[model samples]
Target: MEEFTIINENNEFKKGKVISVFNISNSNREIVLFSSEDFDSENANLQIAYLNIDADGYNYISQIDDEKVLKEAMYIVKDMIEVINNG
Candidate 1:
């Protein structure tokens, strides 16, 4: 699976693999990241949303919500994989 990561506005760590990606009914793209550790279902949903923002090629949206820290950290770690792939 592919991987990518991003630092949340609050500066936390999130790590996960790109389990899958697909478009919703509206054609909006969505990405999923499965956390490397255990977390509640709510946290999982937040992580999905946060990482989506990070991976959508909008690298300049400042100030992600505080609840998204774990998700962000996961994405940032996954992003390291992307860096490695490119290099």
Candidate 2:
């Protein structure tokens, strides 16, 4: 699996697998990343990320309409990956 190098605001680094990349159009794109199995199936939109992860057995950070949340989540995930890499 291809891994992504993520750096958080606290100078943390993390590695995540790229689950899937959705191409809305030629110029628009989105991806989903998952670090664990904790996923919800009820909400379609919310689970879009998880579905991509589960369907492909990979992880990826998404680029969706909500840039703020994606950035925050990416920060946290990067921090967590740093901890795992360090230890």
Candidate 3:
């Protein structure tokens, strides 16, 4: 797994790890699976999110959106994963 810190357009930061990646059928897009930790919570449970990535960039299929932030996070996660797998 690769650690990452993704910041939204509102400047909110989410620290997590790239748990996995899924390819979408009939499309040139991929889903970057992530698991974030909520440190403020008592239990510190893991939060999961799926970010979509294409040629243009990344975006989440939700009302809270920021393509630029998602794109940067995806690139970082992808690079880290590739390095680890190749090594």
Local distance difference test values of all predictions, in order: 0.44, 0.45, 0.54
Candidate with the larger lDDT of 2 and 3: 3
Candidates 1 and 3, the one with greater TM-score: 3
Q: Where in model 2 is the C-alpha error above 4 Å?
A: 25-27, 30-87
Write one digit per residue (lDDT tens) for candidate 2, span 49-72: 322354676644543456665565
Residues 34-80, model 3: lDDT tens digits: 66554456333233344554577645532214465455555666676
lDDT per residue, candidate 1, 1-87, as tens digits? 354345544675444445444333432434343433223333532334333445666522233345445455456556756887997
Candidate 1: minimum summed lDDT over ten consecutive residues — where? 37-46
List candidate 3 stretches off by more than 4 Å: 42-87
Ranking by TM-score: 3, 1, 2
Candidate 1 TM-score to native: 0.33
How much lDDT does candidate 3 score? Answer: 0.54
